[model samples]
Target: MRRTTTVWMTGGLGLIAAGVLGMLRDNLVGSAGAPVIAAAAEILAAAALLLFAIGTSRESSVVARRPLGVIALVVLALWPFATQFIGRLLSPSEPIGDLAWSVFGVASVLVPAAAGFIAAVQIARADTVPSPWNRAPLWVFGLHVVAWVVPQLLFAAVGADDIQGLAGLFLTLGKLAYLAGTLGLGIVAVLLANRRRTTTVPVFQSASTDRD
Candidate 1:
């Protein structure tokens, strides 16, 4: 396989592993090794995001040609660290920290959602990837929105009684959606990598034939 293809496959696997580890960490909270699992998940997710950014930027897809799409991918890749690590470390009671947390919280939701929407639209319009695979980004965006909104709606509807159980159930569902979305992204990346390899072979052969 080509080096590019290997990168895509490795990144895809990393995403899958990160999702699995994240779920495991959630389930194992307060357990002996929960912190370790959480750290592993965070590291894997960051690595996967970087790899994906590299893969998308190098690929010949229509999305890669669009400046907005590239910017969105880069922003999405970096936003997690800001929200997950740096923001979390800040004390919410302090003025500067409070402002930072507010910015992080809003940006965490809006920025990613906007970025995903932009990327999804570009992916949907692109003909480089095959039918459903091309629409994978759209699904990721849609599911992500659902994951964020549904839990809140459920909480609003059900009220505070039995909050723990209801919250846990919806949160798990949200996590499942997130997992599915990540899995979809991984599949799409692999598909795109294969598609790139397949398309390039014909051009090379055609070039060789013309010289013969």
Candidate 2:
């Protein structure tokens, strides 16, 4: 394996270990403050590994899907952090009508904007072959969108007094979903990488025999 590939796979392994530990804690009492935090960290780690793996892959010679995916995942992962900044801008007594409008505006705009960013990356690299794991990022993105939506609906249902509260909830869901999807997709990417290698041998062997 190439140096970068080896490094990435190693990173992926580390992330897998972290995720497992997090899961164990999740099952146990006081595993962590919240399941989402652990999950998000794991996803970010996995994404890092996947990015390296892509850098190493021969397929990446033409296109670096892993990098593209990584960027998307990172954006999704940091999504929750944005709430903190947004909250500071709003006054404590902001009207629900204005708050709701603003929240909806950002969501409607940002969600697709993020997705489009990822899609654009993929589209730019359409000429290259994508590893199975490349698709994993998109899955995370999809869930991220749902994550963004659920809290809004919940807030609307409950009639939250503060838009900041609603924003916090949305961020929480989005972060959790982002992490879960990242870990899941990371596993998928590793599996795909291995599977691709496994399958390549037979084709190479057949070609060698034919050449002989």
Per-residue error for 78 in candidate 2, Å, reads 9.0
Candidate 1's TM-score: 0.75
User: In candidate 2, which residue ranges exceed 4 Å CA deviation?
Assistant: 1-15, 24-54, 61-133, 161-176, 207-212
Candidate 2 steric clashes: 0
CA displacement after TM-score superposition, residue 43 of candidate 1 (Å): 3.0
Could you estimate the TM-score for every candidate? 0.75, 0.51
Model 2: colliding residue pairs: none
- When summed lDDT is taken over every stretch of 10 residues in candidate 2, the lowest stretch is 57-66
Deviation from native of the Cα of residue 38 in model 1, angstroms: 2.5
Say what the RMSD of model 1 is. Answer: 3.7
Write one digit per residue (lDDT tens) for candidate 2, span 101-131: 5775678567646744574356245443354
